[model samples]
Target: MSLRIDNQTCYFDTDTLHERLPANTVTVITDSDKPMSAVEVAGQRIHITEAQAGALTVAGATAGRRYLRATDGDSVI
Candidate 1:
């Protein structure tokens, strides 16, 4: 899965989920080593299927941008 933030809108894309976040909100990406069963953004949680965890990239405004990803048992980036 991948997440992108543009201005006040956030686009979250994955094989099973695609969502647009509200404007001017803080999103806290959870940090967990276990394969993701769900994702939280803007205080909303969306469940996901079991799969190999992927990388995360967050870039945009300073105050509203944040990202977290689960380490694949090796390292956390």
Candidate 2:
């Protein structure tokens, strides 16, 4: 027997430009190696699926819901 769930996997990259974050935006978790800091989560990150990332922002995101960025290239994700 096999069980399957309709859920998409997500992957986000750090922002190379490091621009300032706008208002009403939410950050997603990307750091799988280590737990993300609360402060970092609030100020950066975009909770978006890989498919939805192309249209969101950065000329790649696929959905507006996944436009969050770290505003820095060296940002720990």
Per-candidate TM-score against the hidden true structure: 0.38, 0.21
- For residues 38-71, could you state the per-residue lDDT of candidate 1 as single tens digits? 4575445644333311212233222312255644
Best by lDDT: 1
Instruction: State each candidate's clash count.
Output: 0, 19
What CA RMSD would you report for each candidate?
7.9, 14.0
Q: Which pairs in model 1 have colliding backbones?
A: none
Q: lDDT tens string, model 2, 1-77?
A: 11111223222335532333331242333444333211132245433344333333333212223224565789984
lDDT for every model?
Answer: 0.46, 0.32
Clashes of 2: 19
- lDDT (Cα, 0-100) at 21 in candidate 1: 60
* Model 2 lowest lDDT segment of ten: 1-10
